[model samples]
Target chain A: MPNYPKGERRRAEILEAAFDAFGTVGYRNASMVQIAADCGVSRAGLLHHFPTKESLLEAVLKQRDRIDNEQFFAGGTSDDGLDYLTRMVRLVEHNAAHPGIVSLFAVLSSEASDPGHPAHVYFQERYARSRSWLRRAFRDLEQRGMLRPHVQPDGLDVEFLSLLDGLQVQWLLQPDAVDMPARVRAFLSRVLTEVA
Target chain B: MPNYPKGERRRAEILEAAFDAFGTVGYRNASMVQIAADCGVSRAGLLHHFPTKESLLEAVLKQRDRIDNEQFFAGGTSDDGLDYLTRMVRLVEHNAAHPGIVSLFAVLSSEASDPGHPAHVYFQERYARSRSWLRRAFRDLEQRGMLRPHVQPDGLDVEFLSLLDGLQVQWLLQPDAVDMPARVRAFLSRVLTEVA
Candidate 1:
C-alpha cells in the first residue's frame, strides 16, 4: 500500500545486481550487459539509471558506506573506547555473515591503491575518515581515563586499524580458522583496560 | 663476461619485464604484448619462454618469494626471537625502497581472495608458510624465556602476522605517514623481553 517511486525501486534493483557482478568476478571482468541481465532489465534500461560502469561502482560504494554507517555508528551510544570496541566486534560479526560484500570491499580497496584507479580517492578518504573516527574514540576514552597510561591515541588508532584490516583478510582467506570477533576482542583487551 | 646459457639470460630478461608490467598495472590488465615490448622481443618469442600469462605470474610470485627469503632469512642468524624480529624490521626497511612490488602484492593478494582467482592457491600457501615460519621463531623465543609468560607462541604468531600484514597495507596506502620498520620493532619490544 505504501507508495514508492518505481524508478527509485528499479535503481536499487540495478545496484543490487551491479554489486553482485562486481563482487563476484570483479570490475574488469564484470560486464554491463551481464549486470543488466541479472537485474532482469535490458542494457539500456540499466544505463538509464547508471550511465557508465564507473558511475555505478561509485553509487554502489556510497550505498555500502551509508549502510555500514547506519548499522554500526548510528545508535549514538558509543561514548568511549570500550563502546567503540564493542561496536567493532559487532561489525566483524556482521561481516562474517556477508562475505560477498566484504570481498568486494577488499578487492576494490586493494585495486584502488593505484593512483590512477577510479576509486583511489574514495578509498584514501575512507581510510582517513576511519582513522579519524578511531582517533576520536581513543581520545574520548583517554579523557575518561580508560586507556593505559602509556598508550598514545594516535598511534593506537593506526595500529588498531591495521589489526582490523589484517584480521579481516585472514578471516576471509580461512573462515574456519579465524574467529574475527574474538581476535578483535583480544586486541582490545591487550591495549585498553577498563576503569574500575 | 661470465659464461651463461643464452636461453637462461633471455628468460631472466623476460621475467624482469614481466615483473615490471605485472607490478605496475596488475595481472589482469597487463598484456603479454606489452611485456614483450618492454623486453624488446616479439610476442611469440616471449610466449616461447612462458607459455601463458598465468605461468608468467606464477614465476613472478616465485621470484618475489625467492628475493624476500634471501634478503630476510638467508643469513640464518635469526637464532632467537630477537634476531628474527630484527630481520623483520630490516625487511620492512628494504621494502621501503621498492614500493612497486609491495603494491603488486597488496593488489594480487586481495584479488586472490576469490576461490576462482588464479593466484588464490598461491597466496593461501604463502600465508601458511609465513605463519609457520613465524610460529617457529616464536616457539624458539618461548623456549628461550623471551616471550611474556602469558603469551603463547601460536597466538603470538597469529597476532604478529596480522600486524605485519596490516602495517604493510597502511604503509602502501600512505608511505610518508608510516614508519614501517619502527612499527614492527615497537610491536616486537612490547611482546618480547630480553633475557638478562
Candidate 2:
C-alpha cells in the first residue's frame, strides 16, 4: 500500500507553506510554484495534494477555523452568554500573539468580497454562521437582561463581528496603537451590563 | 499646449478604469494591460500617465481620499463633536450607495497590512491620521460632557474606526443584511450621550 502517513505529512507541510504565503503576499500574489518550492515539493506534487490554489486556500482556511473553534470552545461550547463573550476576548488576545493568523483572515475575507472570487461564497456563508452564533450569545444575554437598553438586537451581531474583523486590520497595520483585546472588551462593556 | 485638456481627460478615464478593476479583483490580481484596454488606451499610453502600477494605485487612493474628505467636510471641518459624528453617519450612508468605494477600501486596507505591500505606509499613516481626527472628536464630546461614563478614552478612536472598517466587509458580502449607516449611528449612540 501507499505510504498514507507520509502523504498526510506532506499535505500538512504544503498547507503550512501556503498559509504563510497567502498571509504575507495575499492569495492573488502568492504563487503555487513558489509555495511548492518553499515546502520542498515539486509543482506536480503540490498539485497532487491541493489540486489547485483555491483548494489549497480552502484547506488553509478550514485549518484556521478548526484551530479557532478549538480555542474558543475549549470547554465544549458554553451556553452562558457572558462566558461566550469572555472566550471571545481571550480569542482576540490569542490572535494578537499570532499576526499571521490575523493577516490571513483579514486578507482573504476582504479579497473574497468580490463576487467573482473563488472564496466569495465561503466568506458569505462564514459570516452568516458567525452572526448566527453571535445571535445565540446575544439572545442569552437578552434573556438574562444583561444587554444594555441602548444596544439594539437587530444589528448587534453584524456590529460585533465587524468590530472584531475590523480590529484585526488595524492591529495588523499598527499593533502598538491597537490593543485588540482591550478594544473588544471595551465594546462588550458598552453593550452588556455585566462583562463577566 | 499639446492638448493638455485631452491628456487630463485621458488620465481621469484611466483612473476610473483602474479604480473599478482594483475594487473588483483587488490590486494583486488586476492586470495593468486589462485596465488599459478597459479605458480604450494602448498599454504604452496608459504607462505614460501612470508610469507604474504602484503609481496608479497611489493616484486612485488619493482620489478616493479627496472625494471622502470633500463629502465629510463639505461644511469646512466641523469642530462640533456631534456634528462630526452626524457627518460620519452621512458618509456611511453615502458609501452604501457606492459599493465600489467600500470594496476598494476594504480590499486594499487589509491587503496593505503586509509590511512589504506598496501601500503599507499609506494605510498606516492614513489610520493614524484617522485616529487623530477621531481623537479630536472624542475630546470635543468629553469637553461637552456628552461622553458616556463607561466609555474609556484610551482606545475609543481605534474601536470606532475598527467598527466602521469592519462593517464594510460584511455589508459588501451581504448588503441586505447590513445597514452600514444605521450600525454606525447605533455605535455612536452608545459612546455619545447624544448622537445628534
- Per-chain TM-score (chain B), model 2: 0.95
Candidate 2, residue A113: Cα displacement in angstroms equals 0.5
DockQ of each: 0.50, 0.83
Candidate 2's displacement at residue A5, Å, is 3.0
lDDT (10s digit) by residue, model 1, range B1-196:
2466988878889988888766655677678998999988888889899999999999999999888889987677745656777787788788878887677787777777878778988888877887777888888878878876544455566666677677767777777766766666656655667621
lDDT (10s digit) by residue, model 2, range B65-145: 999998988868758878887888899999999999999999999989988888999999999999998899889899889
Best by lDDT: 2
Q: Can you tell me the DockQ of model 2?
A: 0.83
Runs in model 2 deviating more than 4 A are A1-4, B1-4
**Candidate 1, A1-196: lDDT as tens digits:** 2365998888988988888777666676678999998989888898899999999999999988877777788578745667877787788788878887777787777667777778878877888787787888888888877765544455666677777777767767777766767766666655567621
Instruction: Name the 10 consecutive residues with the lowest summed lDDT in model 2 chain B.
Output: B1-10
**i-RMSD of model 1 (Å, 1 decimal):** 2.2
Q: Find the 10 residues in a row with the least total lDDT in model 1 chain B.
A: B187-196
At residue B65, give the lDDT of candidate 1: 87
